[model samples]
Target chain A: MKGRILEVARRIFGQYGFHGTTTRMIAQEVGIDISTLYYHWGEKGDLYEAVVLDIYEDLREQLFEVEKRIHGLPLDKRMEIAVEMMTDYLFERPEISNLTLFRYFAKTRHASPLDFRVPEIMGNIAHSMGLVSDKKQLPPDAKMKMLAVMNAIHNFVSGQNFFLTMLDMDEKEYVKGVKETLKFLIIPAFVHNGATTKRA
Target chain B: MKGRILEVARRIFGQYGFHGTTTRMIAQEVGIDISTLYYHWGEKGDLYEAVVLDIYEDLREQLFEVEKRIHGLPLDKRMEIAVEMMTDYLFERPEISNLTLFRYFAKTRHASPLDFRVPEIMGNIAHSMGLVSDKKQLPPDAKMKMLAVMNAIHNFVSGQNFFLTMLDMDEKEYVKGVKETLKFLIIPAFVHNGATTKRA
Candidate 1:
């Protein structure tokens, strides 16, 4: 019962966001009493915190798997795998992008304990991709580069309806194209950067 | 009075989005009565539509100027100038991205006459960048490429708060870094593509 509630909460929060969603809505969707939801989750913010943490954990897991595979590959190869793996993970659960984008643009951010942990995650990615030597003090350029990669993935997922219509593509083609385009655009640049740095 | 109200509406709508925003809020911010606001624009949706149209017009004007300047330039050079100019334009008025993202993710998209005109815009842009020759029946790949570029720019602007915090970059640095990063990633990929096609 607890697991099911959490799953529903994740989807609902992703759809309407924290402000747009109400405990009543979640409970109604779960076909349970609102008080029952409170009994399990405590409060709306608490449930939201759980959802954010869940997403973070999932992202970390995906990053770990990606890191394990691309640990010692060339920079371009690492980026190719990372972009493919991350885009796949995010696309499967696009709610993650939806919720994150909502959090960014939300007018009044609800007070919550769990946040995106963006820097920590970016640091891990920068280090893993061989862009930064230290996660503790990632360079602005490295972080910025990671930002470019991440922003592309998140936007492609979040803006699906708009992008699909604009591109006249089905969902399947959109996914394939997103991965191809990211590689075509990102890999060579970073590979060139890697080469330039080695020469420098 | 009407013009002032539209300006206020654009900002508020960008901030709170269409669903989250209300005529009352706009009136409050504009320091006018609700009746006065309605007198200028029929209702909430009417004013929102006006704002969308206004943004589209601004984009068209910018595109025309971009075309005039980069008409006969190389594809890579065209992309560089376009990215620089468009990023500058969008950053100055981020509400355009905000509202567009909002509209895409918006549940129960409000009924409005003025729409994004995404295909038309993309075709014009793709042609200008030498990705496609026709504004009509844009090839799937061509549209996808344009989507990649547009998605990168929109995400960078829309996710500014989240991205800036993660990157630990000041606003000025963030803007400069974004432009640089886009050029670094996009210019080379397209340039290579252009070069390959020329050889073929």
Candidate 2:
């Protein structure tokens, strides 16, 4: 029961955001009374925090997996795999990008102390792309470059409703186009700039 | 008074969006009563529509300027000019990207039957980039490619609030990084793909 509520909360919150969602709506969706919701989650703020933390933790795990899978790979290959895996993961659950972007731009009065852990995950990505030697001391330009890459991916996933219509393709084709475009745009820049080029 | 209200409406709407904003708040910020707001702008929906059209017109004008400036230039030079101009325009008034992304993802119950005029603009960009011969019938790949570039620009501008913090830089540096990163990532793909290589 508790897990069900959290799942629904994630979806609802991802769609509507903290400013747009309410405990009442979550309860109605879950077929539970407000009291039951309160009993399990305590308050709307707590529930929102839980949802954010849940998303952050999931992103961390996915990044870790990508890091491991791309371990010891060339720069181009690592970016190819990283972009594909991350885009697929986020597209499958677009609510993740929805929520991630919401948190990125929205200045809610109820802003939480938590973030998506952008700096930490950014370092991980920088490390994966061979853009930096140490994750802790990520260069400002590296962070900015990573932001450009990460921002494009998040926008592509979240703005699908708009882009999908503009292109007039089905979701599969849309996803394929996105993966191809990302790979095309990112690979040459990163691989060409680094001395440790794609010898693979 | 009316123009002031519209300006405030643009900013507020860009920040909070149509769903998150209210006439009461707008009126309060404008130092006018709700009645005056309605008198000038009709219902909230009418005002919101006005805001959308206003932005669309501004974008059309700016795009026209970019197109005229880049005419007959080589691919790389045209791309450089376009990215710098568009990024600067959007960054100056980030509410544009803010409201845009909000409309993209927010499934607001009051979603207006209007959009940011995406297909039309995509065609304009494609034609300028030499990706499509005719603007009226853009290829799917062309539209998709254009979306990737536009999405990156919008994301960098809109997500600047989050990104600026992560990079620990002021807005000027952040904007420069975004433009450089954009040029670095995009120029290679489009120019290399096309037969009209940069001889300049």
Candidate 3:
């Protein structure tokens, strides 16, 4: 029951955002009494935070698996695999994408607890891409370059529907095109151009 | 006063989204009575649509300026100038960026009245980039590649604060890095590599 409530809460939060979503709506959707819902999750804020954290942790695990699988590949090959994996993951679970965009526009004045987890996940991916060393330290220049690459892929996947409508392409063709374009952009910047390795 | 309402509506709507904002709030913020606000813009929906249209028109004007400025330049130089102009423009007027993310996540069930304007804007950009000729018809492959590039830049600038926080950099440094990285990625894909002009 708790798991089911969390699942529904995530979808609602992803779609409607914190201000737009109400505890009553979530409880009604879950077919539970308001008090019962509060019993499991203390407040609306607590439930929203849980939903956000749940999404991040799931994404982190998927990224970790990608890192593990691509452990010893060369830089170019690793990037290809990472981009492919991330694109598939994002499209399949579009709620993450929606939540990401929601978080951006919602503009909550305080920092989210989930916010800190992003850099750690990015650091793991950056290390896998050879943009940072095993020490997980990125110099200023490499940090910026890696962050740019990350932003491109993140936005490409999150903004999929908008792009699909804008470009007027079917899903299969759009996904394939994104993969190719991402590779074209990223490989040149990070691998062939050697921008990642150049120190600040 | 009507213009002031529209401007305030754009910022508020961009930040809070449609459901999160109320007509009363907009009216109060504009320091006008509710009837006066309704007189200028008939309903909440009307006001929201006006705000959205206003944003797109402003952006369209900016893009037109870029197109005019970059005329007669070689393809690579044109791309560099366009990316720089766009990045700076988005970062400065981040309301457009926020509204864009809002529209994506909001997922209105019907086709937006504003949907048609996107392709028209993209067509103009494609012509300027030489991805489409004066004929203004894009091959399917060119269309996809061009859209992917557009998405990348759109996301990069819109997702700026999120990326800035994730990468733990000051805003000035982050924007500069994005400009450089966008050029590095876009130049290779569109101009040097000939990805755009290569037919489907």
Candidate 4:
């Protein structure tokens, strides 16, 4: 029942957002009483936080695993692996992408607990891809370039259903096109730039 | 009063989405009676449609004007002007960006009324940039590449507040960075590629 509640909560929160969702709604969806939800998650805030953290942690783990697998490849190859892994992960679990955007808008007035951790995680991944080196802070231009790449991939995966429908294309074809476009955009933006050339 | 209702409706609908908001809420926000809202806009759906159409018309006019201003420029220069104009428009009026994404998710089951019109407008703009010659259908690869570029710029503008906060950067500095990054990504992807090389 506890696990079931979390699963339902994730979907509900992703759809309706924090303010739009209620504990009662989550309890009803989970086929449990309100008290049972509180017993497991403590409060509405707690439940929301748990769902966001779980999604982030899962993504962090996946990125780390990809990093490990591509540890010694050339920079271009490493980026290819990272983009492929990320695109697949995001496509399969679009709720994470939606939830990330939801949290961004919903909590902009206050600092997000995940704010510091996200840059760190993304920084580490970029380091592994040889876009950044150890013992130095990421420069502004590099940061903007990486952010653009991340935004492109994030929107592409999240907006897949919309774009596929808008463009009247098949799923297989659209995904293939996305991969090709990413290769064209990411390689020149990150790898070919003189500042972040592939490391030896 | 009718114009006031539409303006308020645009902001509220953009923030809360179609279902998330209510006519009563708009009435209260606009400081008018419920009957007044009904008098101006027949129903919630009618009001929503009006908002969507108004936004699309405004964007169309802006794009056309940009086409006029950049007439006869090099393909790269023309693209730079179009992107800069779009980035400024979206950033200043983020509600359009939010509402665009909202409509995508909210109405994916059916074809949007703007479906045919949007492509024609974008195609015209692309033609003006010399991406496609007159009296030719946009090829699939070029279409996908343009869509990717559009998505990147849209997401970058829409996610501005979230990203500025996340990166802890100044607003002016961030917007400038976005333009530079767009130039880096857009030039190589669209202009330097063999298929869409500038016309003689």
Candidate 5:
């Protein structure tokens, strides 16, 4: 029952948006009574939070595992893993990708706007940056530069229009382009700086 | 009267979204009859299109003027103009900015999506790349790389979440960061490759 509710909720919410979606509609889609929904999730707001949180937790698990694998990889390799991990994670659940990053962020009146926390996502970024910082490879300024580049790529993939348009690239080609971006455009500036700033 | 209608339309459509907004509400807000609105703009869809198109045209003009002023300037100077142009264009009418980029982009059942038909936006990007292509003196592949970097910056600025959270930096500082990112991360790669190819 819980899984059914979630499946229906994801589809409806993705199609109609959070504001347009109503609990009754979700209940109807789930083929359950309204009382049953309240009994399970307490209320509509609670249900919405749960649905959003589930995606975050799933994303968190994936990101954490990637972080673990690259625990002590060098700076460039770590960045490459980070980019690939983010792209793969987002692609796995495009609906969740759209909901979390695009739909909610685009809205003027977001539910629980003040408390819309994604600490796990931030943790992954900070962890990635830590790997670079610990390498003592880049200059002091390179950490922020690396973070900015990663953010730009993440934002691009999270965008629906851009991601859809990029369907031209096969998975291998896509990953290749991503690595090429990180390699040629991103890595060198920090690499040289890292060598010089080893002490600092 | 037309200007008054547009002002009310911007606010109303923003809150209710394009599909949710109506000619009646616009007319009521402007103290005019529904018939008066149709007399002026023919239909609700026509009026909505006009509202969004006007904003797009305004932005195009603002970008064009900035590009003209920055002609033959250094890469950094041209970047500064691009940032200033985006800041001024969005800040002058943040409502229109949100409506055009965010609200209109949202897929709705009944509403036609915003089609910003102005070709100059792409032209400006191509021309900017042309200038940087000379500076970098790279082959065609490097030029494509330069375009991607600029596109990433464009997406970053136009993105709603980035704008909302970036309150720490004033427009000028934020623009400076973009310029620096372009200069350090992007221009250098192109220049490096271009130099390599030239030597080869």
Candidate 6:
């Protein structure tokens, strides 16, 4: 019943958005009473947090697996593995991805508290980048660049329609755009500037 | 009176979203009768469309200026220009940016027609890329990737609170992230693959 409530809640949140959605509506959608939801998750926002946490856990597991798989690979290959993992993970769960990405942007309004795990994930990526690049005194600009790229990748695969419209790209072409964008936009700024070695 | 109505409509629509906001409320907010809105915008949906169109026009004009200014620059320089324009555009109009971006991802149970000039903008960028790249067979995935990057840039520059919390990045870091992200994540895939130069 708990899992079922969450599933229904996910769909409700995805469709109606946070404010537009409500506990009673979710209960009705799931064929349960409003009391049942309160029993399970306490409040609507609580339920939202639960749903978001569930999605974040699943994504974290996927990222961890990708990181494990890419161990000992060449730099480029590792990057590709990371890209593929990130893309596939996001694409597979586009709705949840949208929720997360949107939540990230919406945080500026202090509309809601941010997910606690976001910082952890960003920190992990930053640490990884630091290890890859041995250069001391990395310019202030380099960090900004890294965050921007990560944000871009996150928004792209999260199923936000902004990019699709902006590019006027068909679905297949959209995927291809990701690959090309990764190569051209991400590499020159990060790989050489970011990496300890600048082979390319 | 017409301008006042539009402003009230923007406020209500932004705060309550499409389904949550209504014409009656907008009229009340404007201290006028609901019928006054009808006189100005013809209908509720039309009012909504006008608000959205206003944003589209403003964004298009800003971006167009950036495009023109950087027309003669190299890809790197052009990317820099894009980053700056996007950053400035989103920050300058945080409310409109938030509403438009939120609307971009809002899901409808039914297929709905999309408005806004985002599609045209996306196509313009893709066409520009096509002109620069000789690749005959640009895949859908590639296009999507481009979309993702663009969305990222948009989302990042908007300086939404959620992003600040999740990434632990301030405005300076956020901009840096955008640049680094473009360099590391985007440049590599496009440049190394030589997809840009590949002839059809």
Our model 6 lands, by Cα RMSD against the true structure, at 4.8
User: Candidate 2 regions off by >4 Å?
Assistant: A195-200, B194-200
The better candidate by DockQ, 4 or 6, is 6
lDDT of 6 by residue, B1-200 (tens): 99999877876675456766767888888998887778888967677778777777776676567667777666655655565666666665665665665666766434445566555555555434432342333345545554655566566555455555545567666555655554454444444443455333
Best by lDDT: 2
iRMS of candidate 6, Å: 4.8
Itemize residue pairs with steric clashes in candidate 2. none
What does the lDDT read for residue A168 in candidate 3?
Answer: 76
lDDT by residue for model 4 over B84-113, one digit each (tens)? 988898888777877776654443222335
Report the Cα lDDT for residue A7, model 2. Answer: 94
Local lDDT at B169 for model 4? 82
lDDT of 4 by residue, A1-200 (tens): 77899899987786666655778988999888899999998967778888988888877788778778788888778888888888888888776777776654433223335533677666766675567676147666666676677667767676777778766789998888888888887766555663344343
- Looking at candidate 1 chain B, the ten consecutive residues that score lowest on lDDT are B106-115
In the order shown, the candidates' DockQ scores are: 0.57, 0.65, 0.48, 0.38, 0.25, 0.41
The residue-by-residue lDDT of candidate 1 on A70-175, one tens digit each, is: 8888878888888998898898898888877776766643344455677778777776666766678877876777777877788788778777876778999989
Kindly list the per-residue Cα lDDT of model 6 for residues A59-166, writing each as its tens digit: 667756766777677665666666666776676667666666556544321244534665455444443433334333334344455456555566666554555655
> Residue B42 deviation, candidate 1, in Å?
4.0
- Top candidate by DockQ: 2
Stretches off by above 4 angstroms in model 5 are A22-39, A42-44, A103-105, A108-114, A129-151, A158-185, A188-199, B11-47, B95-105, B111-120, B131-200
CAPRI class assigned to model 2:
medium
Better of 1 and 5 by TM-score: 1
**Per-candidate TM-score against the hidden true structure:** 0.90, 0.93, 0.89, 0.86, 0.70, 0.77
Q: Which residue pairs come into collision in candidate 3?
A: none
